[model samples]
Target: MSDKRSFIYMALVLSLITIATRATNNMVTTTLAPLGKYVFGFDNLLAGIIDAVVFLSTFISTSYINPTLQSSSRKKAFISANLIIFVLLGIFYLSNAVIIWIITGIAGIAFGLILPNLISSASLVDDKRTAERLLSLYSTSLSISLIIGPSLESYVLSMFGYKSVFLAFLPLGALAFGLSWYVKFPEVKRETHGMSAIKNKGFISSVLSITTYNVPFAALTAFLTIYAIEKFGVPKDLAYFSYIPFFTISFLTRLSMTIRPFNSLRYPLLISILITLIGLTGMVLSPSFYSFLIFMAILGIR
Candidate 1:
């Protein structure tokens, strides 16, 4: 196949696997909450801490997590993220212990490895403009997965055992492995421009804003399900399923704004910040299941 054809095919595969894994993250929190309580005997505060720690670790890892140099190295880093998730997921199936934190750390390491490469890989797959759209499609997959992940997870938990949901992700991980073989990740391009902010306002404020947004984002990823499971005491399945509505609403909102016949790159960065703030408020005050669902949906939109 031609390179263009390969790019398209790879984009589709990336979307499918990414959505599957992301959904697993959103939905699993609730199921694990009860397990943490009854099986591992954790209090709400402690469970929240466990949830918080994962993102905290992810934040720390982000700085160090560059894609490996060789194509094989990059592929290994990419697939290994899913592979690690697969293993930890299996561990979750067997035991509900403090080990989940270790698992979360492993998952975070995988996330760090996988996500940056997607950004870099997008540039390689096509020209810059096309790359953004491709990455957006990739993002869309996760959005769809976010929407579907919760619902699918919820269904699996309700229909089968909670343990089954963990198993559901293995296929996604395997698919990632299969697709990794086909990814002809082009050479890493070098930007001629240096990282100097010629038009910066203040050094301190820039640093503050850059770091602050990640706090809530990380916090939400870590604690949203825990909030639903522990604070609201929603059933594990229902909590897991909540991701569906969240993703659906958010994705629709994005599609509406983005997929117009006209091509517009207006105020996305500003809009994102506003959306995030709004979503963060919803998440923090999300005491009931409905509220958590709303917040997650808003987060998805943002």
Candidate 2:
């Protein structure tokens, strides 16, 4: 294939996988709530903890995976991880065991393996700054999915039971596996550059800082739904919708950053962390709905 044809094919393929991955990201926390309450007979907090099982793995895996694979991502490992994730989704559906948590962990590792590689590959192939704009599309897809996924889950689960959601997911995973086989990413000419970057403490420090910033966003993904429902007693769908404003604000915020000048990422990173902290604090302490909304905006500055 011509290089342009290859890039176009790869972009479409990744976009499709993004949708499926977003679906899984959405299901990880919300679907587990009912499963925990109905099947496991657990209380609200415990159910939320169960949901965190996947996210914890994502954080831990990404932390380790990001650095080692920066200069050269292992495409075969990504292919294998996708295959494992698809099989695990099948096992989760058929078995209906809490071992689904381990499956979630596997999915998390798959995401860890793929996400950084996707970003790194894109940056390597094109303008690094422009790549952020492209990534915004991916993030927006994930954002819109927060709206679509649970709605689909509610309908499918009601029609065919909770297991049906997983059934629907299986084909999507299979599709991702098949499409991943077709993508042809660029080769890296990083032999000397990789050695130089390895010696640069500044580069390592920058990556570590980026990792720290992800901690709060990861925490929000893990806990936001439970915080809304338990702390606020709002309906799940409504609470979810209520929170769309957060991501909307977040989406806009991220978009705005690309055009704006950067003196340092330090200030923005600090601001994002503070916003998340404020939102979490609001979840615990908000005395009224209005107060919570303010906190929600603060939560979104990320």
Which candidate achieves the best lDDT against the true structure? 1
The CA root-mean-square deviation of candidate 1, after full C-alpha superposition on the true structure, stands at 4.6
Per-model clash counts, in order, read 1, 0
Q: Which ten residues in a row have the lowest lDDT in candidate 2?
A: 188-197
- Give the Cα-based TM-score of candidate 2 against the true structure: 0.72
* Predicted candidate 1 versus true structure: per-residue lDDT over 1-302, tens digit per residue: 98678767768766765666566655554455545665577887776676665655655544444422456666766776667766777777776575676776776666666655555555564367767777788767766876676666767777776667778766765665565555445554432212334244565655655655566655554455556666788766776565566568778876786676335434555676788888878777866778777777776665
lDDT of each: 0.64, 0.62
Tens digit of per-residue lDDT, candidate 2, span 252-294: 6765765675788778767666666667777669896667767
TM-score of 1: 0.75
